[model samples]
Target: MTLTFIQNIGGGFLIIMLLFSLIYFLLWVYCVIDVIRSNFKDQNMKLIWIVILLFAHIIGPLVYLVLGKNTKVGY
Candidate 1:
């Protein structure tokens, strides 16, 4: 009985981890695509953000979303 319970818990943890990984992967892809489509004007800025997000993982994307520039208006 104890063994069965442990197996069930382990399986549940694995499933949750897998789901989190999938969600993270999708979010990362979306962020990269969105950054590419953004009107940042400067190609270097866009590239910088892309590299940051790609190398820095979750925090990188979040930082970009919060603080990155949006070049919709004329500058």
Candidate 2:
């Protein structure tokens, strides 16, 4: 059977979802803290990033990592 099929048969699906949710929460917290502590060229950008992190949830941290790191004071 396929992995998804196996997962759906018992508790595997729940475990997988929970693991992913935990990882996402951890990443979100880390990114939010990083944004708070890092110095940005425009001070307001810090608040903006935090708001984005709070609202965007899934993709905010990812986009920030790929695009926002350049804007930090010392990278």
Candidate achieving the largest lDDT? 2
Q: Where does model 1 exceed 4 Å of error? A: 1-9, 69-75
The clash count for each model shown is 0, 0
Cα lDDT of model 2 by residue, 1-75, tens digit: 688786667687778988999999999989999998899988999999998998998799998999888888876
Q: Tens-digit lDDT track for model 1 on 1-75?
A: 988876778777989989999988887887888788887766678888889998999688677767675642253
lDDT of each: 0.78, 0.89
Among all windows of 10 consecutive residues in model 2, the one with the lowest summed lDDT is: 4-13
RMSD per candidate (Å) reads 4.8, 4.9
**Between which residue pairs do clashes occur in model 1?**
none
